[model samples]
Target chain A: MSDDIGQKKGLTRRGFLKSAGGVAAVAGMAAGGVAVGARDGLAAAGSMPKKWDQGYDVVVIGTGFAGLAAAIEAKNAGASVVVIDKMPVHGGNSIINGGDFCAPGTRLQKAAGVQDSPDLMYKDMMKAGLYLNNPELARILADNAGGALEWCEDYVGAKFTRLNFHGGHSVKRANQTVNASGSELVNKMLAKAKGLGVEVKTRTKMERMIANKDGRVVGVEVKTGYRYPDEKTGKTAYIKAGKAVILTSGGFSNDITLRQIQDPRLTEKFGSTNQPGATGEALLAACMAGAMDVQMDWIQLGPWTSPDEKGFGHVPLFCERLVGYGPMIDPATGKRFFKETGNRKERADAIILIGHPVIIMGDSYAVPKQVFPRALEKGLENGAIKKFDSLEALAKNYNIPLEAFQKEISRWNSFVEKKKDDDFGCMIFPEARPTVTPPFYAARLWPKVHHTMGGLVIDKNAQVFGFNLKPLKGLYAAGEVTGGIHGAVRLGGVAMADCIVFGRIAGKNAAKETAWG
Target chain B: MTRKHGNIRFSPGWLFAAALAFGVLLVYIGTPYAAPKQVASAKAGDCAACHGQEKVFSPSHPDTKAMSYKDCLGCHAKGGPQMLQGKLPGSHLHQLRGVTCEKCHGKVAKPEAVEEKLCRTCHNAEKLVEKTAKVKPENPHTSPHYGTSLDCTLCHRQHAKSENYCNQCHKFNFVVP
Candidate 1:
């Protein structure tokens, strides 16, 4: 099936390399074409190494949710699998993630009496993604998410005890882990994978994909003993994958140089919520190996992060909970600018347009009721979340016009009382009360580069597509590394679902591939 | 290229210039301002052998030539204001504690990176976790992500300044020693 596409393209490996090199040279001379140029230039398949330092049936890049899930599934499928991470530690951004696994018809959802289905979840994803999502891939994610969640629970022994709501979702469907962090799942998955005899190595970075003369990916060139951010370290080595290689190296939100190349507005001025190792080199290396990328410019920024705290701090928990129960006030005008329940992109863009930090506040009633106690406490301890005894005090702290802020609070309270926002159509929850309670809590809001919604293009089966618009044989990808799942923006909790659902698929299919050797 | 000097055939000016250049080269090589040399067999207190007379201690500091780890603790006691717990690199601490370079790196002429298992030879992972269980904020020895399996070098860098790796994403103010 894969060979048919390659034959139809009618370009042999030699011809393809020549043409790609020519195109890269031209692209290199053009302004703002460095990524494309580098991709094509590096895409030239490497010469076969005389010896392989290590061999496995499946070699997975990254140790995040997707890579670990893929390793476990591939191992279970009877393949000798090896997972590698460039970082010294295992779990990538997955460990630091706020564990919100969005799946429809979940046990938690049912227990909470919130009706949901895969179809509803699919619609919400499409709506938030601006209809740019690959419908087939998105459908696969929606359909398989429930089973994946069940696997994570029943098979992997991870616990999900809470049902929560994220903005842009139809209902409360996020199945949050007991610890409220993705480490609950990732660490469990790591243990499970290791128990199944899967070899996991850290500080092993993939330098490039090595494809055979037939244009099939056969292995990867790597730097063993790698010290990250120090390219001078690590010894060059090769690892042959007898069957296939899966790329789940994740997004490039923290790569300031690469992010700015894609979107000039994403300068160093904007902080990122991702781990320091969330760079684009691995994804680019795949692109260099004939993989095609899409929607690289549709980077997602989190609207809830604070400049006061560092990467994905406790303030996000405080701010995300306060939305809809209170108002996000532009301190300059003391007015609500955008809808509190709007999607991530809309809220972030609105804040970016305002040119400075804004405020998201909830009174004592909303704060204590909506916010997680631990997050609230930590945020207060860190001084990211501040308390004010009265509206005047809140306004004084943020330098908001006291009289105008007082009037705005009254107007917002009226909206909450009526369960409607007449101004910006913010979704006012039914249980929300007036913001007249003393000792209101508020946090400053500034957008941080959160997720990159674009990456290597992949099919529904998790096979990566090449620049020739055909499956790149022996190469599979899932999670944030593969794009067209969440189009323009990724809804808050769907990333976990996407990684697990497709990661399993990639692993299984990668194991099933006929050994090229 | 031959200079026509029988026993002293070079021009007098050139001879003087050559002597001056050689003296300058010797001074440059002898000065401690260059990179510090690593002498695997040197004593922990013999700083001058590797440092080439570099002033590593303050002028008021007492001589530490014969001081062992216990002897140094008289003035630099644990938890004291002058404590060297976090101030000194882990390698120096290890040296002071009598774990010489050969203990982990072996007697190889060129020392390479040491694996975590070597660290486990002296510091039991489970015992360290138990020892630090009562640390404020959270225990640094074990975390939800890596548990007790995290590479010790990630936090306790031997040759370099140690850092709390958790502070990259979190605000854990651990004085990593």
Candidate 2:
């Protein structure tokens, strides 16, 4: 595609080189149109190196939950493994993530007396995904999620101390980490991987995947000492992956250009919940090396995020916790909008359709009972979540019409009293009470790009598939880098489960691949 | 006739390959690479020592060639109209306080980036957190996520413009120095 543009623009690679002179001419070629596409701008997969600067049996890209888990498993499976990340810090988004790991039939679930099964989890995922999910991959994720969580707790020594509920779930299946952050699990996994003799190298970035004449991935060109968001900070070197290379570099929620290619609505205007390093270059590099992508347009938006704060702020904790206990009010109309307890896509879409930020509120009773104390205090401190002494004060603060807002609150109160939501079909929690208490708490909700549900297609064994309907030899993938596990929309807390389960599988299978070297 | 340079053989194929290789090399080395400015002396008042010929301060500013840290506070003091605390590089403050390159990086031919421990020697993390505990919006020194465990280098760059690294995910609006 870029070649055609180059040809039309009279700036072909060879022509530019012939027209200009020395090393300075190269910069002119870059400025002209020698490189248009992302892959065209970089080295191709066919650029096989005669020598390597480094060698590993399994090369894992990224150091988040998935990459660390993959490195540990590959090392345990008797393969010399190396995990690399471009960031200065080890953990990516996983470190700052709200520690919610969803799995069916876990110890936490058993202790919490929440009856859940793999079948129920699978059904919920399919229903929320709109059944676009590849059944086999989704089934593998569902069946193995519990085992993965157990491995994290038992083997990695990460604690799952509480069971929580998420939207689009049959039961309270999400197991919260002890520290309420994914760092609890990720840090443990990093320590375990390091203890197992797996080298975790930060500031190392993958430049491009190298494929031999047989069209099999053999190694990767990398740059050491790489800085995040800076393409030129690292030193170039080739790392030969004798066994295989596993791509777990995560999704493109923060890549405006890449995300817009899939979902046009996901422009720069949409804020992202992911770290800035969650770009799609690595995934696209895999595609250039013959990997097939599935459902690239299925980007998920978190409706609970507040526009007032940055990234995935404290408002989500308040908004998500209060969903079943309160009502989502459209400030303009001062009425209940969509079902407060709907799946992320549904809720985000409903808010986007309104073309304005909406409000979710709970009284003093639900605020203290449902919301985490720290989250509430921090949210109030940031002015994202506000407290009102009365419903009148709440309406006045949000510029909501007093009469309609009062009527809506009373109508919502009646529904809460009867334990049924006739207005928006919102699932009123069993323990929820009327919002009659003084000091109401509320937060404004705007959607933020959360997860990219489409990526490289992978099989049950986590082997990346090519356009030819065959496994891309010497290449494996797991976590958000692979698609079809969540189909159209990934449920909350399922990301950690997917990463761990598929990461372990990818590592084991990649280690078992015949060493090309 | 192909242009040959040093050990490289320059043919059409080789030139194309070199162009592509140089393209790849530019990405690896990072474009617009600026070598660290090396000051000849440890004196605080040598404006042209590290800055070279680059005009940093406004022309209307008073001459500061021999000014000390206390002398800098004459106009650019704390709570002033043009405070240099968060605006200037951390290295300038370090130099003004007599902590030269050797203080953190030691006497080396090529001084590299210092460790977090170097900063912790003078600025205790816990103490700093306590000091900024009452800063409005949210505390910049500590956070609920990482607390004070985040490396000071993430925000307080010595040579470059200090950034609020927390703004990557949150709108903390911290004026980092």
Candidate 3:
């Protein structure tokens, strides 16, 4: 029986190659760099395995928010689905993310009495994205984000108990999870996907997207039992997708080589707020299979990260929370440099141009009210956030000019009282109090590479577009893997919204594809 | 006497077996401290079976040939500086407790990497979570991200030194044993 199966496999492989000869010749030249390049394509293009080791109706790569959502939706659509993650654990960066889902016109917004709509959210995204966003994709994200958030809270049994605000948005729209961590949503989604009978396989890395002769992605070549970051480990295997393959593998924020190739300024000097496995191999593998990429250089640096702490540490929570409630000061001159409530890009660029870290400070009143208790406690414990009994002490601690610092504090207090800023047009909330309160809390701010706003180009349906500007057959992409959604900048809480919104679309569409064999 | 001598003549199969045995003997002698052999009935302190004549302990150390895990615990008490939990490789403790190589790896000529299922046969994951529930900072056995599904070998390596896998992203500073 084994010999007969082996003979049949050999015959099929030969037949496949014979039919794919023309495409294989072209793909061979495209994949020539794989032999000499250190970080290039994993497999030669058009190199389908002799036999498929596994089969599923729809195969999903990545186990992040998008991947899990896609897997659950695909499984619910009555298609046999499998989700693969290279990491030993599921929930890529989604697990570690700050739990803020921005959706307009939600219950949280209504209760908070914050007027918001999908149109306003779209405007905020487009403005922050510098009008470079694809109108259709942005519209889809805005329109479906509310439904997706509802699905997360109602269908997946995740909780959003608080309303928050991000700098780019016009009003309070971010619905924060109860635990203040994305693990709440991602873990729930993971459970939901598993309960739906979708096979979730961790430590299985995708090596290549296997496309048929006519350029339809039929399956994926993967490494099973893979040890992450160890290329030599795991055995080569193939998983045939009878219908389609969804690429939800996240961005290349931690991929120094690839990020530098796209943006030379993003060198090793900048630390990334991403997991170690947030690399670009899977995205490049898709590219080798004919998917086109867009805006590959529009990488984002978070302005609120601290050099004192590691990877997206507690300082971000502190800084983001205190933005509208306090003032940001340049330690060198002891004065306000930029708008305290400016968007991430503006703030990060301002700090980068300053050539040193700046300070974001809030009084005791603002600190206790605005900052999350755990974040404030952890930040103080780690020495990333410092406490001062007086403004003079704080200024002395940061080596700021005491006189100029006092003058700036008074100026900021005046703006807060008037609820307006004439200098940088800083937004002051109605509840924001003057900085006259004792016991100030402050944190040093430095930029870190946070997100990449560029990846495979996909249409409104989350169908991956090839270099020919046509939808790639049997290939769908969503979340950070696909570009043109956020364009130049992704707003603070929009990633969760973007991932879920498009992920469901991709999953349902991928499952609806007719089986090729 | 002539018939007896003729009967003692060696066959080709016997000669081949003799040569093979001699080759194995040479290899054994040349590398005394080679990869451990699967000696199921060997005592825990019978280091000579695996280490040959290599000095596994200090010269002043007491003879451990007859000592069991409990006997060793008399000197290396829990929480003591010389505690064996983190010092010795986990396999040694298992061996001292009378768990032979065959118990986990099975009676195979060449033992490959075992999956977490083999460990689960002995150590229950949910029970371990309950046992370590009060560990400071966070429970090492379970987490919100992976829950209790992390591979046992990730933190409790048997052959090599153990590691705290959570320290990659978190500063839990867990003393993983």
Candidate 4:
């Protein structure tokens, strides 16, 4: 949920839980139009906006990691910025995430002495992404990733806590947020904007891009009327630009049609981690103006993101942080998908469908809280797992699977059975033991799109492209909008890195151009 | 079966292909090999006159009244409220760029006086979906869309944003990019 707009969901226990920036996103779209004095001028004169205001050197669309990064960097660069959102809330999914997850050069990485290099990082990621990435973007991503993490810690006030997800990569890149998940990062960005004299406009929807005769961007027409200030009247107005437009909109994971089109099987089965504002407006506009789209076919696979509900699609994943470190058991095949390979696309896709027999079992507090009770009853009733008064009884439930699970149990049972993963490589290891004592438990998990790899293409300079593969003048793109940066699939902590790295680049360069012809 | 256009049949099966075909048809339609139009629209005169009333920023300002079709930008720059909604510089969709309001809105002295049917008359091709794209789109009465007062260029990014909007413009994007 965006700090701009959030609501109390049923997860009130999760603390005044918020919708994923719905209101803030709407304001971004609406206010963006109003700020631009959008022709069709920002909701036809007096429209209600939550936080609408006008004028800026740059208009950064979307408020997730990319947009947030762009806004912060642009303001720091001395250009007035208006960070607009279609979601009523501003934080987006970045806020609801487990903060202290993983990243290199992170304090956690230094402490662990994992012994790594950016080249090694890039090589490993390329292996993970199957080498389907633009070399330049990948190198840049790996080289500066650590600094970006540091920027978050230093600028965004992200507190560093180390956790071993074992999902992807080496070293501990997932850094924990000292505050509430990643809201600290989002808040830090908002605070930075306030400091930089940037305009924060929400509830604005991007209506259209007004370009000049030479096809250079002149302004953007946005729709208003929800709840914002400093917007144009009902008549379309123009917010001329001195530089480029940066779109940081997130992927269309929640869009049903988009999901189906991207991958019918995944969308048909497991729901993706997309919020409502993950609509295609900004992305499509960039493409219509001639940006090339890349690698859209790949989907991020996460077994838990899909919950217990079963139709063609509707799954839930228990919170990763709350679940802690646990071994996911495949019930259908009665084996582990190795361990912590969920973050690796190949590793995830290879074993996810080996018959949905996966049950994540862990020590200490790995037993899932929200759905644990129901899952325990279901496991015993259906015989997917056997409930035992002791570990022996649990063993009988897995007689055929004992040989498989035994390895997992013994590996973590020792004080240092395996600090460095020999199988599926994960830098940090979970502290808990596999011994479930008297009470053994397990829960269901499903794999699906955790993120999107497809987006608009850009040159090394980050200029937006046309149909002929030529850069569109006065048009620049970055963040998730620029594909080929992450290879075919993304590394876990790479999203934040990509956002910061390219967002800074795009903003710096975009600011140099004049929007008006 | 309802006819797609004049002779083409409109059926659910061929609707998509028909839309694409029509989008291609829009590339070259009944016109004098229009690389450019002399009098793009009859209303160009009125738009240039009144656009200065709002926030005078149309690209064609000072020489707007005196210049030919090309020099309108001298007096009126591109931000005037009237000029923006009226699509002064042009529509993102090239076909609608140079055309005057009279071509689609009709040549009546007042825009409202023109029969809405005149818009539908040529715009009935919208059922095909692809043909609905226009450089100078008709009034919503002819092909209803949201945020009408706003320029389609301002918000509606031409490329597929993601697969989600395919539901809204199913014909435009059968495949999610």
Candidate fnat values, all: 0.36, 0.36, 0.12, 0.00
Clashing residue pairs, backbone N/CA/C < 3 A, model 1: A43-A288, B5-B9
lDDT of 1 by residue, B1-177 (tens): 135554656677556445444434443444445677888888887777677788989989888787788988999898788888889889889988899999989999999988788999889999999998998678999986667878888889888778888888778878888
In model 1, where do residues sit more than 4 Å from their true spots? A1-43, A389-393, A414-420, B1-43, B107-110, B133-136
Across A1-517, the per-residue lDDT of candidate 4 in tens digits comes to: 1221222122231221122233333445754654444333212222322332455678777676667777777777777777776544565556544454335555676676766678777886787777888887788778877787788777776566654444457655555666525665666776677677767655666665555545566446565533222232122334545576787777766556766787766654555554445656667665544456777766566555434432112123232432335555565444545545344464456555473535555543444443456444443453333444654555565443666566665654442345555555533345544455556554455664567777777777667766655677766677766677776677766676677677767777777665453
Docking class of 4: incorrect
- Once fitted onto the true fold, the runs of candidate 3 whose alpha carbons sit more than 4 angstroms away are A1-44, A324-336, A362-366, A387-425, A428-441, B1-40, B46-48, B52-63, B71-75
Q: How displaced is residue A318 in candidate 4, in Å?
A: 7.0
TM-score of chain A of 3: 0.86
What's the TM for model 2?
0.83
Model 2 regions lying over 4 Å from their true place: A1-44, A363-369, A388-403, A417-419, A429-440, B1-37, B48-84, B105-151
DockQ of 3: 0.11
Q: All candidates' TM-scores?
A: 0.86, 0.83, 0.82, 0.55
Scored against the native two-chain complex, candidate 4 gets a DockQ of 0.01
**TM-score leader:** 1
The alpha-carbon deviation from the true structure for residue A263 of candidate 4, after best TM-score superposition, in angstroms, is 1.8
TM-score of candidate 4 on Cα atoms, chains taken together: 0.55
DockQ: the better of candidates 1 and 4: 1
lDDT of 1 at A406: 87
lDDT, candidates in the order shown: 0.87, 0.85, 0.86, 0.54
Measured on C-alpha atoms, candidate 3 has an lDDT of 0.86
Model 4, runs deviating above 4 Å: A1-55, A100-103, A106-108, A155-158, A161-166, A226-239, A309-343, A347-358, A362-437, A515-517, B1-177
Sorted into a CAPRI-style docking class, model 3 comes out as: incorrect
Best DockQ among the predictions, by candidate number:
2
